[model samples]
Target: MKDAIEVQLIDTNIYKSKELWQPYRARGAFGGQSLHAYFLLAGNVDRPIIYTVERMRDGKSYATRMVKASQRGKTIFVCNCSFSTLEEGITLSHQVTMPTVANPESLPSDLDIFQKILRSTKSESKQFLLRAEKNINDNSLIDYRAVNQYSNEEIITGNVKTDAHGRRWFKTRGALNDDMKLHACIIAYASDSGLINVAATANGLSYNSESMGMMASLDHTMWFHAPARADDWLLYDIHSPRTNHGRGVAFGKIYSSDGTLVVTTAQEGIVRLTEAEQKKRRKQLEFENGFLGNCRCQL
Candidate 1:
């Protein structure tokens, strides 16, 4: 006899596109699968997001939902997630070795990193910088620290060596109540931050660069491997294997500070820049520096 595994498909649809607006569904998937678990398990909840149930199926102890999400009027994300009634079975699994890294407290927080970056980028608009500074200093629900020690000046100057691997440690800013769904959603949102940057850093690009005017996530996928608290420091180990055609793909493995492998994620993003844009941006930076250089100088 073989160990039993159940699978189900609920419903499906094929949508058509119009010439006026961009077609949906065919483009990308949505976020909020863990929250969907809340909606399903709790059975009485309300959310602003619009979910069109693509499929719903249930077995004796498991249920699954394929959800398409939209906001305002656009299909933003989609996912196929399953939940199960707890059952006991033989359990055996293996995880890759967790990398040795510095303590989260010893590393720099996102606020620290942003402030350092702002110091080096004083040539940018003062209004924009003030807004960014305020956003970082504002009380927040998440705390993040970079495992690698690299300064903003070194990066923006393109004088630092880019590491192929990166790690981040994060936990909730405040204590979170014991809710599995809430914890999962928080982690999902946070996962999007570093993966794209890993690729950009390797290419010696910063999000602040004018040459890279636009960047957007094309698709994202996360798999919950084991239960972990979002409010506890979680280490996200990331690597980017490929970047081409204005796009880059990154893969990540998330481990709890205790060494439990909690989740895995992959995302591909569109990072577009043309040679003309680079040339134009270089001239702009040069002119701005020259103009500011002659103005009553202070450092």
Candidate 2:
């Protein structure tokens, strides 16, 4: 939730580069820009490109393209996307239904929750301190929340379980009225938040200041089944499938109120660790969880 991108269109007549470039900070590339560019490029083609996609996948047709967003040209965010053919081929259909969750109105806003958490802390978890330091100062179009989170320092020190799948509560915090496409694009922008952590969770590792290295999103994927509004609250259900060979795969489902499946996402990331780092982490985990404790397993 901390890293989800938020953009508000200043003009309805056109979307600009700043709007497109903002959400892509998760990756080195700009996702909003790519989405804008994708729309622009598709508009230029002669054929009618009817677009449709599943919400999440990994390396498949509907997976990576939907999430790997970039800026269109220098200003617009174009999601590099393709339209589907209307041809009636081998009829195949299957899907996972959306889960039932609390309504947005029933749940506290992320900001409220964050403020409460900060106020309640006594010992001052280092991980929370780091997150506050890195994120508290920013102003953006969208508001994101990690539904259940420990501080960044707690995570690295093995004070918390890395496999505790993250839940990010999010929505736009502005008055801008976004259309279906704009909302979908915004959701795409926000979907990247906490995706990489699924792998880290499995390994009981965290990105601490003392550690030397890099953590970045390599590729992202998502699918939109039905229309969704970014201005409204959405519950993102995420999980990790595998973590091995210095890499991890994670997937998620976005559900609207009344349990409608709006979107899905999948991501693969590079999780590099030298033997020394792994040993250090193992030692830390052992010290926290105990000598016989299962550091690699979590609830």
Candidate 3:
């Protein structure tokens, strides 16, 4: 997680990314590492990203900042963030009940699943696995274990069942310092892990599927409701409520092991089928229309 979010201060209210991390076959850097900001745009991985922070507002209890990320003088992303001081005492508080799920210890790490698939005898499967392996960090700082397991074949074929909802247990691989802000940043990074994919999975599309043409986040918002440790096991419960046209939206909640609702997140992104898939759908529609026309004439 440290490597994923490392940044160097260049000037007052300006920071530059020390390194950029892009997902397998992604057009731009990962969105989560840009912590506490919205991804208004995306750029390729060919250059370093510079972040400029604008102090929008400052008050005794509330503050706001606007962040713009750019590459080669072109703005690639912009986000508006607001912060609030912790209240001395809670006046009112309520959260929806956290769903019961299997413990993290009972599930296999995602890397373990990837390695098991790498031993497959099928050549096509092996090739796909090789490419998919790039998505996993070699020396990962975070541990992820999916609650609902799926094989690499199922994922590649877009046959894995998500029902528009998914759950995973995640945490930093090692203990982190007792900095609440740092922990929040770590959670921010992890939040983008597979959020937009939840929307695609609702339409039976996976990032690994040839039918999936594009999947990229357009905007992300996070609300920190309470303090939580990133090193402790946390449950990320996510669901996609809608996907229409070329966009999909998903909502997620992060809960501590003891069921404390720590954060809420929302994201929307581009989700589209490949041209081949679109063409196939068109042909099928034409065939159905022709068959129906003949039946009507006979009637």
Candidate 4:
């Protein structure tokens, strides 16, 4: 039982970014909005989170919830969500076509993309790469394919621009048990993955931001317009409207393969770019380059 409990917590941390309870999934149980996940600046991973949910409002067609998450008696995150039943109100025609990209079947796995980035890092980062690779192999629950090709080479050169806008296809690696709530929760989990990266990328910052200091989710909100299956390929199209004063705001829309809009999400994150970490990585990279240069001449 202890082992199972630990595994469940790990699973929750990996998928939902919340280790205590399933918040967004619970939101889908009422059926509408999402969550903004928190990353502890204290660098504590797997810290037990305590979550409490309160019913804010209940209406015929709309419902609201307030969730608070804490660690060590310190409030880490809080979210207020409102859900509404689909109304037959004014419908708008699709004006934006899904940007065509290389198909999921044709693209590299998400694991491969991460492995490339890991390998590009310094030897001290090898352990992180190894751990990440293991995690990807063992628990790759989400399948991902990007509209733009990702290049690890460019990361080393600091010229990587996967795309002007962030676009990707994501679905459960395997089928779910026909639970729509579960699917929505999975999408909520996936939404947290790169919302800020879109912002950073748009603003000429690397996803890792070699000049990085810190970045974290401030708030997350979403609205569901129609039902969707997380097990089927759904496109996540994300873009950043503006970023300044150490904050970046991003918006996303999810569409089923058939072009039906399913969900929309909004998030704002606090991003502080610093030169300290940048200087550290640059020196390490320089050492690696010098070492490689010698190896080549000697051979």
Candidate 5:
């Protein structure tokens, strides 16, 4: 994870990606690497990305910086981050209770799960599972374990419905230094992982589903409530409240192993069905509109 998000300071208030990491079959670079910026466009891995940071505001208690990322002379992403000094005498504090989940130690790793499926599947299905297994083994930087396990059938079919709720334990594979800023960046990078997929999971569609047309994060927002280590076990509890008009919204809470709510995240994204499904939807809409039009004419 640290290596995947590495950046170098090239000039004053300017940074460049040391190495770009793109997910398997992703259109562009991972969103989490952008840190606190709202993504305006997707940056291609073929080109180098340049980030220019502008000092927005600097005060005694608070500071703000705006980061703009560009690739190939096109603006790709933008974000504003605000920082505040820790208060000496803090009083009021409350947080939502973290949901109960299986301990990371007790749960099977994602690689193990994929390998199990790969062993049982036939030759025809092995191709996809093999690719998935290889990606998890080679590129995955975080150790992830899902709270609820899906069967091999469900995994192969790409239709695992869980009522729009998902919980998983995740943390960096290697120990990180004691720099809180770096940890926060790690959190930001990890947060974008599979978040938009929560919307697809709600509708019984996985990334490998044939019926899934397009799924991309439109915007992402996250808030840090307390200090936490990115290398330690953390539970991510997420759920999608609604999905409509090719859009879905999900909210997530990240909790430390000791049940401290350390981070909150909200994201909305485009969740579209395949072309065949979309055509059926369009026909249905046309029928309804035509019926309404006939009623108006009679009136």
Candidate 6:
């Protein structure tokens, strides 16, 4: 029996454009997988590698999203993300500070840990593990490692809150073909693993808990501040900045173990408490239900 991690590509009409998207059933869009896709495409053209996204400057413009793709040290592709906003005076700026803990070299790979658990848990999971291993055994585009191992007995629960965020170290495992965007796209694909769960931890919620409802990412934005080398280990440190009314916001920093910040990301996800579980909790809170304000949630 062979273990496999399904990488099925969805062929919905909305996603037929391979030029802009790659359907990932378990994950999401493969092209939108990472900020690296945009960087790789832009980097291929001889231009400045840094792509900046400026949000809401004046009433005339709501947000300005700019992408500059470069290659051979020159500029190639530049795109502007546009939006409309009404005229109003509002200024706000705040971001979570990066956390310092075990460096990338100090951690294990996510795939190795996943395999260990698969073999230990269910026969089906084990078979899938074998298949996944075969799939990646030859291709060395990206490497993955899980921070803490998950199991049936222990069954880590809730969106946990800790001083150190969940950490993963990934890099290109093989040589590149000179098309930097391909590697970037691969990194985009790899970035989806376990990141959203890290945000759930903010509410003391873990995916293992049945009480936890479905969580899905609604939107993602990333800015490539500097060039990234997938061949080298890059540390992804993610944190949840806010969670209210069944929605959570997470932000992350992609850094070299040495402190070079190469990328930054912002993601909003819909987090909902299951109806059965919510009703169960509601009964227990009937006496003090008014305190939490109707227990309304929007995810």
- Model 6 score (lDDT): 0.52
Model 5 off-target regions past 4 Å? 32-36, 130-134, 280-299
Shift of residue 87 alpha carbon in model 2, Å: 9.7
Clash list (residue pairs), candidate 1 = 10-56, 11-55, 29-77, 29-78, 30-77, 30-78
Model 6 lDDT tens row, 138-229: 33345765455444333323334432256667776565555544545455445655566666666666654556777766556666555566
Error of model 4, residue 214, in angstroms: 1.8
Give me candidate 6's TM-score against the actual structure: 0.56
Tens-place lDDT per residue, model 1, 121-220, is 6634564465456646555446878886665554444334566577899887777778776677678767777677677767766554545655666667
Clashing pairs in 5: 37-79
Residue 118 lDDT in model 3?
62
List the candidate 1 regions with Cα displacement exceeding 4 Å: 1-48, 85-87, 116-139, 155-160, 278-299
Per-residue CA lDDT of model 5 for 77-110, tens digit only, reads 8887878777678679999888877779999987
Q: Rank the candidates by lDDT, best first.
A: 5, 3, 1, 4, 2, 6
What is the lDDT, from 0 to 100, of the residue 199 in candidate 3? 92
Q: Answer with 1 or 2, whichever has the higher lDDT.
A: 1
Error of 6 at 200 (Å): 0.9
Superposition TM-score, candidate 2 onto the true structure: 0.61
Instruction: Report every candidate's CA lDDT.
Output: 0.64, 0.55, 0.81, 0.64, 0.82, 0.52
* Per-residue error (Å), model 3, residue 249: 0.9
Model 1: per-residue Cα lDDT at residue 8: 29
